[model samples]
Target chain A: MEAFHRIWKKWRHLLIYGFILGLLIISLRLLRWKYVIADQSLEIYIGIVALFFMGLGVWVAMQWFSPQSKTAEETESIPGQEPFSIDEKALERLQLTEREQEVLGLIVKGYSNLEIAQALHLSVSTIKTHVSNLYSKLEVKRRGQAIGKARKLRIVE
Target chain B: MEAFHRIWKKWRHLLIYGFILGLLIISLRLLRWKYVIADQSLEIYIGIVALFFMGLGVWVAMQWFSPQSKTAEETESIPGQEPFSIDEKALERLQLTEREQEVLGLIVKGYSNLEIAQALHLSVSTIKTHVSNLYSKLEVKRRGQAIGKARKLRIVE
Candidate 1:
């Protein structure tokens, strides 16, 4: 019973979501069987799917742009919490070039791409190329993610 | 200067992502102009867009399912936190029926429709209808989201 309780705690959310999705798909099929033709049913499916994704994307964007859990105090305390030092091996494994490394360092200091380009005597396009390449290699889509991964891997302090 | 610095800190990450997306779209258009036929170019555009969305979905799913910030201390302290009570005003604002509200409560506890149906002594189809109607009113796709909104609004503790 104790183990069942623990398992239920872990599995309930995902299971409920899966069950709801199954119900949705089953009902869509029923609608098609009763009323809609194949092509119109397909269109309805696509439209509903698109609308669902659009709402999901909006929810995600809200989470991203306005993080709920992070307090102002946490943000203010971040720089003081660490004396970050770069990890050269970690940098090498990420395949960052010397120029790209310089760009990333500037990013850690909160320099915008345009500002980094000016400082490095490179074009904005050049800076963007380096940034995107490094982001891909770091397996992160956002700047915060790249910085967080770098800090975790000891590539930056 | 201080205000500008603060604004830059807030907007920089989103700006960089937007800039990168713009570059991707421009490059796709250029590729179409220089190499591919119109029909094939359109297909490529759709393919790339789909790929981008799929990657974004993966990233969003990671953010949703694997929240990184909850500390051990927070979890341990949760029981000591203030007692959460249901907010009737919040429930009324969502315009949920009594049956729909019952389904939402079950959902918060991670109940599958089958389980909820068994407990409520209703058919699974009836439970599904109630769940779908509530989801539409809540404007969420997943059970996690419905629960999140409910907790946020104090509709469910």
Candidate 2:
């Protein structure tokens, strides 16, 4: 029953069209038997009706499938405003301790050793030690190098 | 003349369809007059022709206007592989000199002043002066801050 429903959903339009065409043929044959269309102009009448239905099909297809709607969807985005999410894989691969990660985040935010110490409630020496450990783990020499590496690796936002 | 060309370009398909439709009607009418189709089955024949043309229209519209092709185009791009272009507007806003820009680019690449001097074939003291100028102009006291600002502002590729 489920498979039958799926097939019916896919081809319902064709089935509906075929049923309507059959009904029209029956009604028209009855009309022809009662009274023929005058001047043998039945072909012209059929040609006009066929062309109208063809145009209707084209219009319906355009409504359902036009690529312009996709282009409109794509043009709505403004670049660089996307929310920042840290790269967890890189952080894990670097094997930075929790304290070290905090220090690195502050360093990327342009905080000084004393500032970081105050913010984290640690001594200046402790902050300095964390900074050095970050540099070693990230394989960089200076603070600028550490910041560059962190941003490039997406280890910090 | 240009306006006429533009209109023609936009409606050429409709005009060609109209011409073909006219020819088909003429030939169909001629066939009806020349050879009478028997048994009053003309309506069924016309219904089949109409449905065939309508299906043709739908197929043509799907081929030319389907959004799936647009989606395929969008999925072809791999994120983060786009070529980086330096922001000239931010560079001009910062009023950085050519030499300062060069030094900043090197600094962002994790270069020490001494390494930058060697790369630029300049003395260490000159590189130090350029670095200091970059720090002051960029309004950042530390090298890390300068690197961060340069990247955030897209002043360096």
Choose the strongest candidate by lDDT: 2
C-alpha lDDT score of every prediction, in listed order: 0.59, 0.70
Q: Compute each candidate's TM-score over C-alphas.
A: 0.29, 0.47
Off by over 4 Å in 2: A1-84, B1-84
Candidate 2: which pairs clash? none
Q: What is the lDDT of residue B81 in candidate 2?
A: 44
On DockQ, the candidate that comes out on top is: 2
Give the per-residue lDDT digits (tens) of candidate 2, residues A34-97: 4655655666666665776677567556645432223332222323333466667778878999
Query: What is every candidate's C-alpha DockQ against the true complex, given to 2 decimals?
Result: 0.02, 0.25
Candidate 2 i-RMS (Å)?
16.5
The worst-scoring run of ten residues by lDDT in candidate 2 chain B lies at B67-76
